[model samples]
Target chain A: DVKVTQSSRYLVKRTGEKVFLECVQDMDHENMFWYRQDPGLGLRLIYFSYDVKMKEKGDIPEGYSVSREKKERFSLILESASTNQTSMYLCAARRMMNTEAFFGQGTRLTVV
Target chain B: GIQVEQSPPDLILQEGANSTLRCNFSDSVNNLQWFHQNPWGQLINLFYIPSGTKQNGRLSATTVATERYSLLYISSSQTTDSGVYFCAGRNQAGTALIFGKGTTLSVSS
Candidate 1:
């Protein structure tokens, strides 16, 4: 079975603070993604990495950045957190194109 | 980017009842997937049906790629099945999947 693990289950940060969410996958997938889930917005992509050092901005990439220094790990960084940034963050990995993506248990972020 | 929409934004059912959920996409897709997000917020991959039909246990899914739509069927629903169901699709040029707003399912005993 594929396993995607996130660094935290819940996090609270003060305004303007830096936040980092880490994700690791054991399946050696080539694509990794970060998404934020809101009540009415569903899951909006924040950022995605197709290969090491290669990143692309998704629909809602503002206020968020991602790092993929290695194939197995992907990290999402908030330049400076704000209350509006609070949401359930999810990490997913897919083996390649045209395949099912596996997701990690989301991290509920609360920016105060 | 492809646009995905799911029907019956919310559904309520009793145990042993069956239900069907629908997903419609704005364009043709190379990959389509179904996911069940449990109450605890875990996205569980239910099916990777880009086309045709696939079944696992009491849950089955069918994707008509040509028609740009998909359907998910849950039979003999249980209380544990209460959660949100999401359908996502990816066009040939994109690596990321665009998801629908999801259908919230509530099953009572």
Candidate 2:
């Protein structure tokens, strides 16, 4: 089974603070993604990486950035946390193209 | 990118009843998948069907790529089977899966 693990299950941060959410996958997938899920909006991609040090902006890539320094690790960074950024963040990984992506449990972020 | 739409945004069913979930995409796709998000918010993949049909346990899924639609069937449903069902599709040349809003299933005994 593919295991995707998040560094935190729940997090609360104050406004203007920096937030870092980490994700690690045991499957060594080549593609990793970051998405924020909201009610009625579904899951909107924030950023994705096809290989180490290579990143692409998804549909909703404002105030959010990602890092993929290694094949097994991906990180989501919130430049300046705000109330609008509070939402459930999900991390997923896929082997290459057209493969079923496995997701982590998710990180519920609350910005106050 | 593909536009994926799922039918019956919300569904309510009785235990032992069966239900079918539908997903429609706007364009050609190379990959399609079905997922179940439990009450606790854990997303689990049910099927990875680009086309044709695949069955696992009491659940089965069929994706007709030519028609740009997919169907998920749950037979003899249980209370524990209630949650959100999402269908995602990747365009013919794309790698990321564009997901539908999802259908929330509620099962009562």
Candidate 3:
């Protein structure tokens, strides 16, 4: 079974604070992604990494950045958290040629 | 980027009932998947049908790439099946999946 693990399940931060969400996968997948889920918007992609040191901006990449220094780990960074940034963040990983993606339990972020 | 849409934004059913969900995409796709997001917000992959039919237990899915659409069927629904169902598609660009708004399913005993 493939396992995708997020570093935190819940987080709270004050406005203008820096925040980091970490994800790790044990399956050695080549693609990793970050998405934010909202009530009516469904899941919108924030960022994705196809390989170590490679990153691409997704539909809603504003106010967020990503790091992929290693193949097994991907990190999402918020330059300065704002209340509007609060959301359910999800991390997923998939093999290069595989169509199915394995996701981690999401992190519910709260910005006050 | 491909546009994905799901039908019946919400659904309610009783135990042992059956339901079918549909997903329509705007362009040709290289990958398509169905996901069930449980109440606790854990996403479980139900199907990876780029263009074919697959089944598991009481659940099944069919995708027609030529038609740019897919369908998910759930039979004998149970209370534990209550949650959100999402269908996503990946276009020829090989980008991440573009998700639909999802169908919220409520099953009552």
Top candidate (lDDT)? 1
Angstrom error of the Cα, residue B11, model 2: value is 0.8
What DockQ does each prediction reach against the true complex?
0.89, 0.80, 0.78
Worst window of 10 by summed lDDT in candidate 1 chain B: B30-39
Q: Model 1, range B1-109, lDDT digits (tens) per residue?
A: 8889899999999999999999999899977999999887989999999999999999999999999999999999999999999999999878799999999999999
Judged by DockQ cut-offs, the docking class of candidate 2 is medium
In the range A25-100, model 1's lDDT, one tens digit per residue, is 9988999999999998899999999989999999999999899999999999999999999999999999888788
Residue ranges of candidate 2 with Cα displaced over 4 Å = none
List model 3 lDDT by residue over A25-79, tens digit each: 9988999999999987789999989999999999899999999999999999999
Regarding DockQ, does 1 or 2 come out ahead?
1
What root-mean-square deviation over C-alphas does model 2 reach? 0.8
Instruction: Provide the clashing-pair count of each candidate structure.
Output: 0, 0, 0
Arranged by DockQ with the best first, the candidates are 1, 2, 3
The Cα error of candidate 1 at residue A30, in Å, is 0.7
Worst 10 residues of 3 chain B by lDDT: B89-98
Extract clashing residue pairs from model 1. Answer: none
Give the i-RMS of model 1 in Å: 0.7
- If scored against the real structure, what TM-score would every candidate get? 0.98, 0.98, 0.98
